[model samples]
Target chain A: MLRSPRAIPYLLLLPSIVVIAAVVLVPVLVSLWSSFTPYNLTRPATLFTFVGWRNYQRLFANADFWWAFGRTLVFVTVALNLELVFGLALALLVNRVTTGRKTIRTIMMFPMMFSPILVGFQFKYVFNDSVGILNNALFSLGLITRPIPWLVNGALANFSILAAEIWMSTSIFAILLLSGLLALPQDPIEAAKVDGCNPVQVFRHITLPFLMPFIYIAMTIRSLDVARAYDMVRIMTNGGPAGRTELLWTLIARVGYQNSQMGMANAMGYVSILTSIAFTFYFYRKLSLSRRYMGGAE
Target chain B: MAEVHLSKVVKRYGALEIVHGIDLDIAHNEFVVLVGPSGCGKSTTLRMIAGLEEISGGTISIGDRVVNSLPPRARNISMVFQNYALYPHMTVRENLGFGLKIARQSPAVIEQRVNEAADILGLSPLMDRLPANLSGGQRQRVAMGRAIVRNPDVFLFDEPLSNLDAKLRGQMRVEIKKLHQRVKTTVVYVTHDQVEAMTLADRIVIMRDGHIEQVGTPIDLFERPVNTFVAGFIGSPPMNQLEAMIGSRPAGPVAVLADGTELPLPPEFAGRVTADQAVIVGFRPENLYPAGHGIPAAGQTLDMDRTVSLSEPLGTETMLFLDFGGREVQAKMLNPRLVAPGERMPFKLDLGHLHVFDRASGKSLRA
Candidate 1:
């Protein structure tokens, strides 16, 4: 009663603002400033001694850093694209299901319910070089006399991690796109059918156009999540086989924790954030374009 | 020649059959309307002809081709839906040409037909706008244009004007009539509104519980409905029907209403009922008016007195609601005179325009 109506809303919102500042804003600003310094975790007093641009300079000249960066770009692109293709197919297939649709949707989300680390461990055992199920099955089936090393080879190791990442995340895309499929007005599809379009034509012309905005939303969210692909790869390979399958997080963790160079790791973190920014920007643009195609305001 | 024909058509869903076996023949360029109440399977019959619903046990032919097993596209029919299902993602030009484009016509042909349809519907100004940008009537015209672009053997409309407001609906009705005249396609339209059925159809098919009770022209249905159902379903503010018994009179036969009031029956229907036979006597509201003030009463006349319960006066006529033998009946009085409540006003009955139905079967006794 003491406060004005306008001021009361601001007063009620103050707690959330304070909480978010403490949890998110402080850490982000501190890390960004630290990325410009020679701060080390072991010697916490070095947090204030700023050696501007030196850490970034050393990172740019480091070949292994660039390799990890390039490898992560490739990994995220291949994994996210495959997830999208499979997720769209799964959504289309599940949309056609009339009976037990709820049960099917719940089952589809089973892989996403597991922790990423658990999925990594599960796939790790399945891909063990000599004793895992994959090589054992290959040996018993007489397809190969020698044991196929799944995790030891560079390409196979990347493929295994990509598979694990896709398995853990594709269902989210399917669920989102399926909900979009459900919300679509059925009249246009019926019109298309009456307008001489076959099933394939209907899917391409009407159904896919309606599903584009949903697809882009899923892509933007998954790009950010897949860029933070640390837990699964850490449990799976730990950047092993002489760093042959090294990604951005593995190198950054090694430099920041194992070598006690937090400032340099934070520098690498800033650069890695650029790739996620690029993907989010690309996907958001595409989402808005599709929305405009549906007659939404630009 | 029949453009679309359904012989012994039926529609069943699992254990329940909605449409019984029925027959309909829509001749070339004939506009036929199926009018009924809800759940009367009028839309089902239309869908069966469009190949949108699977027919259970009969043949539907489009111009001599038995399209029983064919899809809607193969059957070559177009439908205008109730909601005007224009594609929200496409402009009007694209929406109109989509059917032809899918049928693999050349660019010039699709363009020419789309332009022609746009010209017919006067949709050139809105051709570049998406469906969402257009108003409801514009969207409806675009829908009609989409159907016109197809130019198929038959056009099926499933309550296409049910969504419009009354004024827009009236306007669309006139436009649709003109479109039918210009396009000259066989049309099988379905609506529950008797007014729309009467205004638009060359022949009206009145359905009740999935069965066609009668099929006739507007004048035919209005003047000679086959039964009580057809009589009630065909007119607006429907015909007033009173329970009565056939009685012998010294002059002629009479319908003795329940309250001991005797109204003379026409001599043409003298033998349609016997003495003491229970019957339903029906007459249009216009037939009962203030004595000597109606448009000649339109039939053989009998004088009576009834008290007005409520009066609704329009500019041209007053609709007088009165009790006839303890039954609520509406009567029209021309020249707009105020008749107060509880006033026993002299009225006339057009006995020549009366209907007598056997109460047991609800069937008309007239030959």
Candidate 2:
């Protein structure tokens, strides 16, 4: 009874822990347990029936699932790398400007501030084949004669979605890398110049290595966000035409919400979780290695 | 191996001129210390010489080459920053060799130079350690070693020891002196500590508000200060200045204190006295002694019934702060006893070493 005063602080945190477990952890575990049965949302009583990996067996045989899995990997990898390149270029350009720097930084964050859904609607109007501004400009300039099927074709729709995803999230990488650039110590740069290092040598040896950790941090964050590229892809193509742009999310949504196969959808969700985990682990390892390059383990 | 000459060098930051047009000539292998208070533009002057700062007006030359427009690399001068800005990502060995490597020097030559610098700094065991793993003193030594391996014509130090603790500062001061002696590089060092300026400098340039107040050897500035600022700045415990009036008499000159204590001045003050005017009396604490030690009449002495304020007994000598005639006076006593507070002690001041300064200009009348 005397220890109740000291224990009260921890006791107060129990409510928050319980809420989080009920809302987040319990649902994930329940879904994971249901993946072993033939549970359907329409037939709720079937959740207790044991099916023993029948959904996973069906998933292994389903060619559409395999196609969707490969497509998601390619979409994530391309979008992330492209965003990195564009983000690095933007950061470098903005870092060089001495005046109007604050205005430029604020403008750079404008794209990131808009909700991804709004971005999808905006790009959807812009890339629409019949009455879109892009095609109208092209036709008026004598660039094209016919209405191009931008969202209907397989490669073009995938590229259009990838382009929108890159544009929306590239600013996140720039802001992070720019802060890294600002925090770099000026002494090494000065020392290198006095040591007769040319501009390229100074950047390759000193500036780039110092920016590696920040780059990895940005990469980790963006990779997770890109792996779940759903909003724009969901609104524009909706895995349309013939499942040409069907990523994992669209396939999972179709299986669970449209077809009511809750067990198969849960199994797919668990498998997709490994992609985010692998990326996070990879970036974390790189961050630690870069910190070791700077000094002892940070 | 090079002589640096600055002719009317000026540094201005958008009309706020920090380093006024000042001329100086540093002969080959001469160590000059620029001593001043903070914001006195001493470090700015060194940076100008190192080509880190733009010369607002006038020419700076190294070995007869006007380097006013040259960059830091082309100027062939190295600098040690106050923070010891070693590259945190590189090992000690790589940090020392980075410069030579960037310059495209031969691999063997770069290796040999780095080895020599590493040996000079006694960093053989720590060559593999990054800067985050090293101590402050080790990092400072690496900074020096980095500068040394460049073998530039001149070296500049921007108050490099200000970041260290007092004991380490004293130790590094000796090491820097030894390094300078061995290398014989024409070095321009900047510091605000007068003791550092006194101990390390061949010539000390005292600055005030962007103007050169005085430039002379340490002893020259000590024995013959051009003004009250230099007089008060270049000594430990500081030279004591007491407000008084100079009363010229038929015999010689006498400094009359406000408390009506008249003291005869030095014998060489026949021609430098004006009529009745306000003046300041300056003397070192070490010059004052107890009155019973066969005091002379030609040298003036003051007898005061003062309560001891604070007594600092520093093994060989003791510092006593005594309240005298509404002002505080610090005296350095040779064999001081443990005098408690509120005890009246008979203190006397020696007048032979007394200095008189004009109240309006703060210029020493003796100089």
Candidate 3:
């Protein structure tokens, strides 16, 4: 005989799907539709009038958009790589410890618990041009003779934001890599020693390769996280001084939310989404290759 | 190859001592097995010798030098873990060659050595495969291969066969024996399986509660146990013990069971007795045979009225579980015709092969 019908399962799933569609899917579709039109939030009637490729054309010629695009790429690339380096160092240090390890691990996760907005505000005040803690401390110590223009200089402003991003996100990498380190088999390390391997060699050949999958996983996750790096950048510089630190998000926010040019902003948003997909795909490919290199699959 | 010695070696984790001071001298190229129940210090002792653990007191010497301060690399010992801790991310070839590569060996030398190990282990065809791709037995072989490629002075195994299935354990046990015979390295193996200890050890060290109770040839401990613990832990199906009191003192010293039946103690043991001292009488399951075979030729004998409780039949032998007085005892018979459960069969206790222990100290009454 056929089984009895089960409406309860479908009923249970319906509410969640409705909520997700309302909160997530609707916004995405509405934005996609708005990208093809000359829709401005101030003029609601323009939602139905399609403007072909004019918004995309404006973006293609816009110097501000191109610069912001380049700056965003540099920011993500430098921040992610630096975070990986610092994270790997921290994980190795923690892994070498013999006592009070649990306490150390919990403490390392403190930076990750703070909101990005809070981190930005904290660092912003610390690096303020005239009255900042860093300048004041340097001046009092007779270290720097002048008050350095930290947030005003174009290059220094961008570098400061990059440094803040690295500091805020490095712990994620360390925690993930530390778990990989802990799960490693003790046998291979012992065998390496019996085989007459020194510590550095063991780390390079055994430890590093074993940790590859974890590193790539961290990279993939952080690429997505950094692609959406908005709050910190907004609080610190706001694409500042002369648009020197103007990343894609700040540019898009100004266009879409502040200026209410919803259509042009949606076009920029779609273009920026491609950048995230590209980074994710790159790291995902690296992860699979590492696994294959380890002979997990033929 | 070298001899290993643990002279009063001890291990303590804070206030709890896992291995008391143990003194053992393993001869060159000797195959020594440490066997005991769980919570015994057998594995801890092996780990100490391997330099994986620090000696809390005393000294451990590989060959003739004290290795207390040496790191595992300097100790020149390889360990085969119970789980066969092969690196899951590396191919067999990579895993085997990793140590050599780390030492910066010449590429050609590393290749030749890895190939030789692969050939010896019969892992050539699977050299490019990862650990996940191999079977349990293959993984175990690779673990052995990893150890062998180093050609260290001592081979330490920590219950290596414990992770295998029964059939696989038996097969690997023979393979290990053959490997030892071929390579002739000094081996310190630890296991709780008496059968493994019996079949492989040149000398067996039996331990209990962080102290070695006895160390001897397998037959030495089996035939002349130093205490009740060694007597009970050595033999298969275990030795049977019963509480008894001294009686029938005029003609000979005899033991009276709970049922008031009488059995004579061995003539050699009669001198060590008093009438009121409590004692535990011990005998192996195989030492008690069917009564028609008559009593053993030497020493005293006892005939018991036992209620047969269970019968376990094997191709070459049968085990009879029978209750004597108030306690159960196991008796083994050679290829017996047929015996059913609950049968009242007479059995002879070979008293010359029996053991007696002081109940208070669990120490043997006589050698």
- Candidate number with greatest TM-score: 1
| Sort order, TM-score high to low | 1, 3, 2
Q: Quick one: best lDDT, which candidate?
A: 1
**Among all windows of ten consecutive residues in candidate 1 chain B, which has the lowest summed lDDT?**
B291-300
TM-score of each: 0.95, 0.90, 0.90
Residue A225 in model 2: lDDT: 85
Over the stretch A53-146, how does candidate 3's per-residue lDDT look in tens digits?
8899999899999999988887888888999999999999999999988999999999899999999998899889787898999999999999
TM-score for the second chain in candidate 2? 0.94
The sequence of per-residue lDDT tens digits that candidate 2 reaches over residues A185-277 is: 887777676666667877888788889999999989887788777788888888886999999889999999999999999988888888789
Report the Cα lDDT for residue B140, model 1. 90
Tell me the lDDT of model 2 at B4: 93
lDDT by residue (B1-367, candidate 1, tens digit) is 4488889888999989888888888789999999999999999998888777899987888899999888777877889999888877889899999999999999999999999999999999988998878878888999999999988888889999998999999999999999999998999999999999999999999998888899999999998888999999888779999999999998888999988888888877877789999999999999888886677855578788888889988878889998885599988889977778888889887788889889989998888
- The CA lDDT of each predicted structure is 0.89, 0.85, 0.85
Candidate 3, RMSD to the unseen true structure? 3.7
Which model, 2 or 3, shows the larger DockQ? 3
- lDDT at A67, model 3: 96
Candidate RMSDs in Å, in order, are 2.5, 3.5, 3.7
